[model samples]
Target: MPHFYFHTENGDCIRDDQGEDLPDVEAAREEAVTVLGEILRYRGAAFWETASFSVIVTDADGRTVVSVTARASDAAPEGWTLQETGE
Candidate 1:
């Protein structure tokens, strides 16, 4: 197994000081997608404030293995809003 680090960039650079041990790069990629989804689900509104969001995964040697990014393609439509009922 190899250790992997997942660093994120939205408005600020967040580094994963403590990495995880994974089987391979493919597993890390899947983890990145799941991590991004959780961030979006909990912080969707704040996330959109930034131009883009990204997850840069690096291996134990600090070499980038995989990357995932999401960007806002267009401006939000008029009257567009997100409401949460604490669900």
Candidate 2:
């Protein structure tokens, strides 16, 4: 089992485990992005056009393994910037 840390652009975070059945970093990242989209929708923001989100995958010892950044489409609302820092 691998531990995954999901970090958002707005300072939110969550943790979960990637079981043996699904062991790829990219696969885990995709699932985290999906969860992030749901979080944006719950916050009354646009998941595909207004919200900018990202994820930092880390191992149990807090070592980063991968990062995934997702931004709203090019037609996103004004004043929205898709930037992330601190991996």
Model 2, 39-87: lDDT tens per residue?
A: 6668645455545666666656667766666565658678888899879
* Highest-scoring model, lDDT: 1
lDDT of 2: 0.61
Q: Write the per-residue lDDT of candidate 1 for residues 8-83, one digit (tens) a residue.
A: 9998989999999999989999999988888788878877699678899999899999989877758776898988
TM-score of 1: 0.81
Per-candidate clashes come to: 0, 0
- lDDT of every model, 2 decimals: 0.89, 0.61
Which stretches of candidate 1 lie above 4 Å from their native place? 75-87
Cα deviation in Å at residue 29, candidate 1? 0.7
RMSD of 1: 7.4
Lowest summed-lDDT stretch of 10 residues in model 1? 69-78
Off by over 4 Å in 2: 11-22, 46-51, 71-87
